[model samples]
Each structure stands twice: as structure tokens, then as C-alpha cells.
Target: MFWKSQRKYMIFLIKNKSEGEENLINGKMNVAIIGVGYWGKKIATEYSYLSKKDAQINLYAVCDVFDENLEFCKEKLEIPHQTKSLKEIFENDEIDAVHICTPSETHYEICKEALEHGKHVTVEKPMTLNSLEAIKLVDLAYQKKLVLSVGHIFRFDAAIEKAKSLLEQGWFGDVYWMKFTWTALMPPMVGRDIITDLAPHPFDILNFLTNDWPNKVTCVAKAHRKGQQEETAHITCEFPNNLLAHIEVSWLNPERKREVQIMGSERFTKIDCVTQKITGYENEKFFDMPNVRSNTIGDELSYFVNCVRQQTSNQVSVNKNNGLVGANVVKLLELTKKSMINQRTEPVQ
Candidate 1:
């Protein structure tokens, strides 16, 4: 029994594990959401819906530059307050955290400003546009003692969650090779490259699914479509323990696809993170793994909000990277571009 439990009677009946008794009502935590665009709307909607199940959280505010979007969210959630400027949000001292789902280019500035406000922060993936800014944000969050979480939404997928648990349990034999494919008729770059906008999800998922940091990176890129940054590309990265991995990301596909295949000596696991389904093959037998029921995006946001309430446990395992992830992303892009440049000079093999 605990005071934190919804039943107030439990506080009086409960005994502390060591001290015998204590009561505390640390109460609800408030969350402020910035951005009301596609991704932001999804996260805010989930946070609002989850709050119904979780009484300890209040989705206190929503902010966006667009008045119509703000109004839509307010009407959708029945919340009375929505603001256009983030100044209105950060001005509220009661707000304890922020989630950013704006454009990739804006990630660094928004996240930096939120951190300086002493608010715990969660921003959509890629960390930032480049490694330098990403490093600064990671370092600053630690300095402020505010929880910093990157919305690596797939990290909350039950398939990867189960994979991590299986790895710990040694269910899969010695691991070997992993292949991931992410194909979509990706949005035109317009102002930013597809590489910058799309690669982070697959990159982060590969890392999460493998539970390893890359040691070396090499890549090949192709730009078949005009005015697009590498409409098709292949990235290969090496991890220690002789584990090899390959990733293919393309905007050229006529159909959307998201898949990961992990190969072990005894078992091979294939998952479609996009569809939230997984299949495994072992000993010449094909089997479907149990359902992966995580509302991953929702779960990720809720987890961040919950950690804000807990106030002690960390949210992201690799929270402080000094922009190593961004650096690696740059390394991959550079290597792929180098390959493309060299391809023009070399004769057919």
C-alpha cells in the first residue's frame, strides 16, 4: 500500500519498507506541449487521452503558431487553454516539462530554450540538425538536472522491448547479421533533405533493436529523383562482437514499407515496426511472436510524463550522447555522398 495509490485509505494502512510508515501527496504533474503540427498533434492527443487513465498527470497546455490548430486541439480535448507563443507556456512556472514535435530544423533551438527554462524536455528524434547542436543540448540537460528524453518512439515498441528482454534472457543464440528496410514515397525535401528528415527513425530503431553502439560506418547513396536528397540510399554500420548490420532507406518506393530482420545462430526475427508485427524463424520452423501491444508513440510520451511525476528515475537510457548519434548520422551521410561522388569517376567493375 502507498499514498501514491488512488485509494486514500491505503496511506493510513500502509507501512514503509524500512521506516514503517509515511504519507505524501506529491500530486499531479503538469506538461506543456509545444508545436501543434502532425507529430505534435499525435503526441498531444495521446498525452491527453492517457491522462484519463493516469490521474497523476495533467496535459495543461498546448502551443502552436497556428491559431486554428490550437483551437482544434482545444476543442478536441475540451481544454480551455491554448496559446500561440511558447512564451505563454514557459511563462507558467507550474509547467514541469515540454515535448517538441516541430520541424527537424527547429529541434535544437526549441529544445535548448526549454532546457534553459529548467524544464525537463522531450523532442522528436534526430536530436538536432547536426552533431554540434545536439551535443550542446545533451550536455545542457545534464547540467540542469532536468530529464531530457528524445522521442525515439519505436524504442517503446513491445517487439523491441521483448527483444531486449530476450537478449537478457539469452533466448536467441549468438547474434549474427541484421537487416532493416524503410521505404516510403517520402515527402519531398522542399527545404530539407529526406536524409535529414527520415533517417533518424530507422537509425534509432536499429540501435534500439540491436542494443549496440556502432563502431564503423560506411554508406552508398543514390539520387534518382530531381531536387531530392538521396531518394535511395544504403547505409552499413559495424558494431563490436562481429555484429554486422545494413539499412536501406528510400523515398523512391511506390509503396510504404518498414521492416527489420535480426539474424541469430538459432533464431531469426523479422519485425515491421510500422505495422507493429513480428515474425521469427528458428530451426527451419516459422513462428509468429506474440502480439506487441505497445501504443508506442503514446507509451513514449506517457513514459516521459510519468518520469516527470516520479522525479527520480531516468527516462532515456542513452539520454546524454554529446551528439554522438548526430555525428554518426553525419558520418553516414558523408560516407554515402563520398561513395556517390566516387562512383562517377570509376569505371564499371
Candidate 2:
């Protein structure tokens, strides 16, 4: 039944692409959004807005299994093309790239298929549930000569960029340790736990600021809810130069907080991730740091589009949230789970 519907959809897309070949000749990149749910809708909106300003980009199509989502894209977003079949999107030679905002479990297969069809892909984080799957996607994208990016949106945050600059300039001299607090009170997701769902941001942020991966990790986690998957977790990571980092993620906390603090011999710096605000303390005095906040999702989508264009033109493109970075974060997630299971620190492989 599924294959029959997909075959019809593919034929429809082929006919449409034939009529639209002239548009592609102008070097305009046609992009699609798959899975227009909560987060995917936001990504689509950013692309829509970007397309209005950039003549090189076209917010060409959207795909979702739900009829209401497709309707929303057509009626609300004004996207021209809508389909429920992944095959149709992959087979459409007019689509140069796709933004995948589907569930984490589906990332591996969707990404693999997209790459196999010669389409550039940028997928939401935790690229895949397993490290091996993530690695395979990375290798496949490289072999296909396609741009594969992950939605590590926080790396584009204004506050985070400022923090990285300050650290690079030795503003926080001789950094000691860093702490990340990401907590909220929310109902448990169907098949997701705190580590996989929430820990990637902090882990990736740690790497963004320090430019280093953790050497060892120790984790303690528990489930206070109905499922066996942990809802709260505390991860301790050891990085180079004896730098220690801690990440606390929970779904049980009443107060929602997304924060990061860095302690050093010269000063203490704290970032409010949600507000994009930064504060610093030195000698018992506190001061505000300059932060010009920007929409991170907008920045991220723009960067991905630029990368796609560069790749299409055979130019060297620098992708900060590349596939390898996503794979490493997935590996850390696996090691974190392993540490929790063994009740011991595990060396990062």
C-alpha cells in the first residue's frame, strides 16, 4: 500500500519538475522541509523569510504525513509544493536540499535515503540514536559529495558566540570548570529520555566554547516517572588542560532554566541561554556583558543555505555544525548511557 502511493507521488513530482526545469537553470536552489511539526514549522518559517530576501534560495516544498501539517504549509506558509511521500521529495530532481525535522529515531533512515538520492541534508540534533548509525550517515554524505549538517542551533546563539570570543581572548583567565543547567517541568515524551533529548545542547555547547571533546565521562541518572528511561541526569566530563564540565538536565524541575556558568581564576561568567544575556563577576562585583541577540534558527538556516550554494558551485564551504560534530555528540550520549549503566567513569572512544 505504501509503495503504491509512493510510486504515484513520484510520477507526480517528475511531471512537476519537468515543467519547472527553467527555474533551476537560473541557479536558484530549491529547498524542502520534511516533517513540519513544532520545530519543523519554525525551520520552514525561517526558510520562507530567508527566501524572500535571498534571490538564490527558493522555499520550494514541504512534506508531512499529517494532512493538517500540509494544509498549514499551504495556507499559512504559502509554500507551493506539498507531499506526504518521502520518495517523491527524494526523486524530485528540482529539490537541491532538504531540512529534516522528523523524530530522532527516524533521522538515520531519512538522512541515509536523502544522501543516497544526491540531496543535501540538514537534520535536527542527536543525528541518530546510535553512534554507528551517525557515523555511517557522515561517511555516506562525504562519499556522495553532499553537504550534511546538523541542527546544533545553539552554536549560532549570540550569547554563545560572545562567550566563545571572550574565552578566546582570555577574558576568563585560566578557566577552571563549567556548569550547564537545563531543566524544565514537562510531560515525558513517548520514547525520549533526558540524556538523548536534552543533553546534546550542553555537550555541543561545551565543545563550541572549548574547541575540545571530553576525554572521560561519568553520569548518574534516574526515572521518577512511569517509564524506565531516565528523566533527569547529571553528567561530568573531563576535557583537556584539566578542564572539568558538568551538565544537569531534568524534566522534573518546576522552574525552567537554561543556563551556563564558567568559573576561572580571573572571573566568573554566566549565560542565560533563553534570554541571550551574559553576566560576569570579578572581585565581588558583577557586570553585564554586551550581547546583541539574534534569531538562532534564522542564522542556522541561512548558514545551511549558504553551505548548499557553495557546495553546488564547487566552492569550499565551512560548516560549523557538520555531520562529524553531530556523530561525536551521539557518541558522547552513548558513553553517558554506558557510564550510568556501569556506575563508573567511561573513557571516550
Candidate 3:
């Protein structure tokens, strides 16, 4: 129902655009979204909604392994094409792009196949289960001259973007260190742990804000439920210029939290990713930072559409959520997992 309402709002925008913003977008681009699970549905809805606003872009198809999901997309969102086979979507020449919202384990093969079929690809983070596969997908996207984006949503968050801009303006002078917390209580998911499931968001956000990658990682984790995956973990990363980042993730916390704090010699900033709010503190004074609040998922999809429309690798969009950046995040996660196993700090290889 919420997505349906969003679609209506988009239709209103489209009606308004016809009068004034009709020339905003240059060319038409067709996109398909594979996997209609929880996250996939959101991506598809945004694409469907935005298609109304940008006449050039269309939500060409939606794919899922389950029959019911396809039915829902067709009936609920009025998507033109709904399929149970990925090959069907891949075979459609009209689809210029695809968003991969499937499981982490399936990301590599799906993204590679999409790129091979001459489609720009956007896979949900972390890009792949490991760095090597991610590198391969990145290389394939480069070889085909297609845009490869990873769904690092926090990069599109208003608060995070604002904080990044402030840091670039040197508002927080001589940055020292930062901390990230993402915790919640939830049922265990097969083949998922705190590091792989929840850590990616904060990891990518830190990389986005710092404009640097971590060189070293130390991780400590525990599986409290005896036979299940690790439910809690702490990871410490060392970045260039002696900057440090600490992340804590858990599925056992009583109170949910998604926050990042960056401390510097001059001042400090606190960001709430969920609220899209940021506050700066200096000299015992706290001030709320102004930011333009926008639906990050919608913004991310729009960026992908623009990239697809641009076509050429030279003119392709580049940001912290690109394949290369996603690959780096995977590399760091791999190192963090290694550290957890060896009980020692590991250099990011």
C-alpha cells in the first residue's frame, strides 16, 4: 500500500513534469529488476514510480523465482513484464539495465550474466561473497563499457552526504577516529552473520565519509545461540593517515541503533542514518545540520538510470557505490572474517 501510494505521487510528478520538466531527461532507458524478495520489491517499486516522472525511463520487467512474487509485481505495481526465469529478462533486448537484489551468494553469477548480455548492472551490497568474484564482475563491467553499481544505500542518505560535504569543506579539521553502531534483535538467517549481513552498511558509510579505504582489520565475534551463526561482532579498521574506524554489529541488542560518530580536533559530527539527521558539536555547542531529505532508494535508482542513459564509460557516473568501491568493501570484509578466524589483525590484501 505504501509503494502504491508512492507510485501515485510519482504519477502526479509526471503530470506536473509534462508542463515544465519535460525536457529534463534526454533519452529513454528500460530497466528490469531481478529478484522480487524484500529488498528487490522496493527497488522495483522505485523504478516503477520513477518511470512516471522520467518519461525516458521505463520499468520494463520484474523477475522472481517464486510465482507469487511475479503475480504481485504484475497486479500491484502494474509492471509490464513479470517472469520466473532470469533468462527471459536477459533475452529481452529492450532491457538496458538490471538491478540484482538476490542473495549475496548469487550476486556474482547474476551480475556477470547481466553484464555479458550488454546490460548495465546494479547489485545489492556487499557486491559479492568475496573480493575475487567482485573484481571479476568489475572487470566484466569495464570490458563491456557498462555501469556497475552496488546498492550501498547509506551513500544516498541525506545525513551521510551532508557529513561528507562538511568533511570535504574541512569543517571537521584533522579527523582523528570514528565509530559506527548497527544493532538489532532478529531471528537467525541461514548462511548469514553479523559481519556479512549488517556490517556492510556502516563499512561503506565510513568509506564514503572518509574518502579512504581501510588497510587493516581486527575482528572479534561470538555465536551465542550455540549452533547458529555469529550474532555479535566488533571490528576495528585502520585507514590511511592513521585514521581509525570501529564498528559494532549484533542481532542481540535490546535497543536498535544505526549511528556513526566522527571525531576531529576541531569538532565532531553525529549522524543518524535512519532519520537522515546530523548534529555537530564543538565548544560545548550543539547545532543541527541542515540537509535535503529524499528517498535514498529513489535517488539511487535515478542515478542508475542517468548512468544507463549516458552509455559511454567516459560519461558513466562514478561514486562511492560503484563496483570498484564495492569490491574494496568486499576485500575489507574478507579480511575482517579472516581476522575473526585467526584471532589477529589482518592486513587487507
Candidate 4:
């Protein structure tokens, strides 16, 4: 019921905000984007844009353990303040929020410390290794009255957002099984596997849309990618009301593909995330849903900061909406971990 009610509330809220076509995020927040790596750089760039053009936030500093990463961000963005320690942020009373773009393993420790110090935190996907850890972190943030946000970037996707709109308006009929595939080829195990790393976006977004967790999950994986970890997995999730979702993740494909096909009773919706486009198919009827595309990268960071500085309505709701997304991610990660461990020692034929 939490998901159902929140969807209605979200619909009402966004409709009101869109009427004026004015900026939804209006306040300036003092913020720092930690872990200056891949997505971390995106966070910094968004913050930098807000600082330079939009004035939606003040990019306080960039923090990272690797001196090279710190220097890279500092020189590339012309940012002056750089630190290897998170202590500087807590010591200063001025900073209000911290964006953590670190690895999955570090999310718990970093987010916990930040929240303990009363700073709002936005940790990247795969919120934690498991649900118990996620439950604890979210609970702590709530106890501290701090906003804990997860970087499930696709939740902010224009197409997915529109899908939510359509779903609310009863655009799609009784939902049927949906399929989501995300695949890419990379230099051998340069990093993590596909299921643990790549699958979170789709998994999180599915829960975000349906407002329900998978009652059961099963996964099958392979070790074709030359790593101890299984780089590809075919997984399925069963939710209430006969809603099923199939997720496939692989790092062994040639051309990378990221797409979702949400089948409903009346029609089917195929979304191409990379292209940011949604195509709909119905018997004797085929049409396209135009992009409600906003500057997700800019708007998302601004949204998190604006919520903190304004002290009003925000997107990341603990135990309300965003928490479930994190919980679902943890559940999926557990299955992935099990698959990885079993595959690593499967007696060779």
C-alpha cells in the first residue's frame, strides 16, 4: 500500500509543479561529491554546472582517497578544495550534504558515518551487499533525521518517469511479465560483474514503478568472461498480482544493449534506455511516447540538494518509497553473490 499511495501522491505533486514550467529546485545547498571516479565525475560535473550556470547549489569540495583522482577532479573542474579524508566535511558546520559515488562495498561505511554526523547522503547503486545492512543504514539515517538517497539513476530517467505517469493514468492495463536486458563487453574483469553492477538500475526502477518487492527470485549464471566471478546472469523476479520481470545482465556481448519491454494487458511498452526513447505496441495499434526528457543528471543532483536546503518536499523518502528500492537491490545482490560463489568452484567438466 505504501507504493500505491506514494504513486498517487507523486502524480499529484508533479502535475502541480509542471504547470508553471518553472524550476522545481529553487534553493542553494552546500554540497560535496565524494569518490571522484566514473559516476563520481558525473556528480561533480552536475554540481559544477549548478554552481556555474544554474546557481542551484554551491560545489563545496570534492573528496577521494586516490590523490590522482582528487587532482584530476581539481584540475579538470578548477575546484580548489580537495581532501582525502571525510573528516574535513564533518568538522565544518557549513556543508549540508554529501554525494557518495564510491564502490558498492564502501557504501555502508561511508553512508553510515555521514548520517551519524548529520549530513544528508546520496550513495550510489547496489546500496549495500545485503538487505540487513541496507535496513540498518536506512534506519540510522531516519533516526538522525537525515535524508538518505540512493543513486539509482534510472529512477530519474525521462522514459521511466513517463511510464509511471502512464501507469497512473491507467494507460497500461493489467501488467504482464516484462523483460529487461543490459549487456556490455569490457576488458576482462577490469571491475565488477554484470549482475551485481549493471542489474541494479533496472531492478531498482522496476520496483520503483510497481511499488512491490519480488516475493521470490531465482538466478542462473556463467563464468565465460575469464574472471572468478560470473560475468553474466539470467534472473527472474516474481511480484504480487502475477507481475513477473526477467532481467539479463552480461559483460560478454559485442554491442551493448540496454532495453526494457514492459508488457501490459492492453499493450506492450519497449523502452530503450540508452536512446532515452519509449516505443509502445498494441494489437492493430502502434505508437511512440515522446521523451519527457529533462536534464536528469542536472535535475537529479539539484533535486537532492534542493530538498535539503529548502527543508520541504523531496524525492528520497525513507521507509516510504526510496527505501523499498534499496531493499530490492539488496535482495538481488544476495542472489548474485550466491551465483558468483557457486560458479567460482563448480567442478570443471
Worst 10 residues of 2 by lDDT: 17-26
The stretch of ten residues in a row with the least summed lDDT in candidate 4 is: 17-26
Residue 68 in candidate 1, Cα distance off native in Å: 2.1
Best by TM-score: 2
RMSD of each: 10.0, 8.7, 10.0, 7.7
| Count of backbone collisions in candidate 1 | 0
Whole-model lDDT values for every prediction: 0.68, 0.87, 0.82, 0.72
In TM-score terms, candidate 4 sits at 0.84
Candidate 2 lDDT, tens digit per residue, 164-225? 99999998899999999999999976778999999999988998899878889999999998
Candidate 4 all-Cα RMSD: 7.7
Q: Return whichever of 3 and 4 wins on lDDT.
A: 3
Which portions of model 1 show Cα errors greater than 4 Å? Answer: 1-26, 312-349
Candidate 1 lDDT for residue 51? 78
lDDT of 4: 0.72
TM-score for each predicted model, relative to the true structure: 0.82, 0.91, 0.90, 0.84
The digit string of per-residue lDDT tens for model 4 on 8-124 reads: 534654464421111122355678877999889988887888889756568888889899888887888877689988899766667778888988888888888887777777888
Q: Number of the top candidate by lDDT?
A: 2
lDDT of 3: 0.82
